[model samples]
Structure formats: structure tokens, C-alpha cells
Target: MKRCGVGSKNQAKLQAVASVFAEVDYDVQGFDVDSTVSAQPFSDEETKAGAISRAKAVLEKDVEIGIGLEGGVMQMNDGLYLCNWGAIADKQNHVFTAAGAKILLPEEIANGLHRGEELKTVMDLYTNRHGVSHEEGAVGIFTNGVISRADMFIHTVRLLYGQRCFYLS
Candidate 1:
């Protein structure tokens, strides 16, 4: 089987990529690669940059394709909204990127993020849960489990894959 790499050890992210590439016959694997961005990106641009960085980093592992997923919060006049980005990079260095759905965060969560706390930490405290990021994530908590973090990343990966196929065609 051909190799495809995900630039994250996060189980949810790795699973998302695996599920997407399963029908395509790629041997999906996850790697612990640095995103080369903030631990908690505060804007859509930085979040996308992190995803692209990871995607490119995974290329060093000799995979034909590399994927990266990143989640963050973006501030707007209305409120802070959760943001997610994904990127796909091929050996040719061609990159495809996409963003997932966004949802407004509650004031408390926003405040904690503004106070320099990572979303995973603040969300765990707010929801009184552990490993929420690896599980349902803030999107799941806020959306009442309507969309888990993995589900969100799955959608993002699909977008990236579709974009890649489009460009290839």
C-alpha cells in the first residue's frame, strides 16, 4: 500500500485521515510533528499556517501525501468563534487547504481563551471533563455532541481531498 502521513499523534485526527483514505488504498499513519505555530492559534490565518506547516513537515517521512489538521478560535465583532483548518500536501509540494464549520463560543470560554488559556484546558474546566479535545472537543460540547472534533476534522479532510483531486484532474 502507498503511504500517507498525518502530522499529528492525536487519535481523532489520525482516525479522520485513515477513514478518508481507506477506500483509496493508502497506508495512513500519524506522526508527532511540530506545527511550527502557537500551541493555541488565535486567528484563522495562523491556524491555517499551522496546518500547512504540519502537512509539509510530514513530507519528510517519505509519504506520498501528508495531512494536517488544526483547531483554534477567531475573534470577530460578534464574538469569538471556533475555527478548524486542514491541509494536504503531495511530494510535488502542491498544497490544498480547507476550513471547517465555525460556531460561536460562550462568553466564559471566550474569556478563558482571551486570558491566554488553551481551549482544551478552558473547555475541560468549563465542562468538568478530561481529554475533551481527544474526545468530543469544544465543538461537541457546545453543539450538544452534534459534531465531534473528529467529525469536524473528517469534513475538513474530505474538503482537502476533494480539492486535491480537483487540481490533479
Candidate 2:
């Protein structure tokens, strides 16, 4: 079986990626690795750089396929938001990337987050609800359940892998 190494031990992220490639007959494996960039990556270029860094770290293990998932938030004029990015690097040095959907935040919440407050804290302060992290809400308290971040990551990976497969064959 072809083996693919994922850059995180987060079960949810791993499962999402695995489900997408499962249809293609690849054996997906998850590993614990730091996916952080030296600097915060709020833009596409920086985010891609972070993903590449993680992929390179995984490649050091000599895996046939290396996968990295990165989550970043940027502040727009309106508010803060979530940006999830993924990268796939093959042993031959071919790299493919996909970005998950963006989730915008409210202005007040964005300011609070920029001050280093946790999402859960912000949610509780704004909604008086507990455990209301991004994992609970699609974007923020105002927009909950409108989308699934996990689904976004899965879909992105599937699309990227599809494109990469064509080149590999």
C-alpha cells in the first residue's frame, strides 16, 4: 500500500484528510510534528511558506507522501478570520497546496483576539456560552454552523490530491 504521512496528531484533521484520499487507495498515517512558522502567516504567501516548512520536516522521514495542515487568522477591515491551508509534498519534490474557506469575525471579537484572547473566551464573553470555540461554530458566535471547517479541509485535500495524481501518473 502507498503510504502518506500527515503532519499532525490531531485526529479530526487526520481523519478529514484520510477520508478524502481513502477513495484513491492510499494508506494515510498521522505523525506529531510542529507545523508552526517562524513568523505569523496571515497571507497566502506566508501561509504557503509555513506549509512548505512542515512538509520539508516530514520529508526528512523519507515518506512517499508528506502532508501539512496550517491554520492562520488574518484581520480584514471588518474583523479577524480563519484561514486553513494544506500542503502535499511527494518524495520527488513535487508540492501541491489547497486552502480552506475563510471565516470572518466580528470587529469587536477580532480586536479582542488580536490582543491574544482565546477563541473560547471571546465566544463566552460575546455569547455567554461555554465551549464555543471555532470547532463549535463555523466562524463566530454570530455565524454558527453555517459551514464545517473540517469539511473544507477535506474537500481541499481531495482537490489537490486529484490534481497531483494526474501528474504522478
Candidate 3:
């Protein structure tokens, strides 16, 4: 069995990546490292640099595969938007990255975040609640158990798997 290292401690992200590669017969390993490169990557070079940082961190372990996911908000002509980007690297030092998915931010939330307020704090203030998870029932779901961030993350993992050159055919 091949070993793949994921550059995050977040269980959800790890599980999502594992589930995607399970079909290809690879064992997934999760590791904690400084995946943060920059909160704002406006250009392609900056974005790829961030992903490279993450990929290199995991590659240091000499694993067959390394994966990283970075999520943040980027400013656009319209407003701030959420972007989720990922990268996969092999022991040969080859790397591939998924194109970012952008989600438009509500003006109020964007302004709050710009003012140094954390996203969760802004969500709490607006929703008049505390500690709402981004999971199934918290904010990700739309209908009753109909949607989830996990689902989104899973889709991301699948996309990455499809693009990953190291995956078994």
C-alpha cells in the first residue's frame, strides 16, 4: 500500500482526502505543519507559492504522496470572496493544484472581516448565536440535512484525485 501525507490536522479535511484516495488503494496520513503562506494571494505566483509551501512541508517526510488544502478570502472587483485551493505532490517533487472555487461574501461579513473580526465571530454576531460549526447542521447545510461543508470538501477531494498524476489508473 502506498502512503500519502496530508498537510493539515483538521480531521474533516483529512477524512475527505482519505476517502477520495481510498478508491485508488492508498493509505492516507495526516500531519500538522505550517500550511499558512498568505491570507491574500491575488496573483497566480503567490497562490502557487502558498500551495508549494504546503506540499514541500509534507514532502520532507519522504512519502509517496503529499496533499494540502488552503482556504481563504480574496478580494475582487465585486467584493471579498472565499477561495478553496489544494495541491498534490509526489516524492519526485512534481506538483499539481486545483483551481480555486470562489464564494461571494456578504458585504457586512466582508466589512467585519476587514475590521479584524474573525469569520466565526461575524457569523455569530449576525446569527445571534455562538459557536456554530461549519459542519452539517451549523452553517454549511441549507435544507434539513441536505447539504454540508463536508460534502463540498469531499467534492474537492474527488477533483484533486482526478487531477493527481500519482493515483492508480
What are the lDDT scores of the predictions, listed in order? Answer: 0.93, 0.70, 0.67
Model 3 clash pairs? none
What TM-score does each of the candidates earn?
Answer: 0.97, 0.79, 0.76
- Where does candidate 3 have its weakest 10-residue lDDT segment? 133-142
Model 3 TM-score relative to the real fold: 0.76
After superposing candidate 2, which stretches have Cα over 4 Å from the reference? Answer: 38-40, 117-143
**Tens-digit lDDT track of model 2 for 1-169:** 7777888766556777789877777788787777666334556666667776676668776468888876667766766777777888987889988887787766786777677765557667887765444344435334455555566668768767887878788
Q: Which stretches of candidate 3 lie over 4 Å from their true place?
A: 39-48, 118-147, 166-169
Residue pairs in collision within model 1: none
Candidate 3 local lDDT, 14-123, one digit each (tens): 76787788778988888877765655454445555665577668988757888877655668889876556678887766777774545677888789878876665666
The numbered model that scores best in TM-score is 1
Q: lDDT: which candidate is best?
A: 1
lDDT of 2 at 102: 82
Quote model 2's TM-score: 0.79
lDDT of 2 at 99: 81
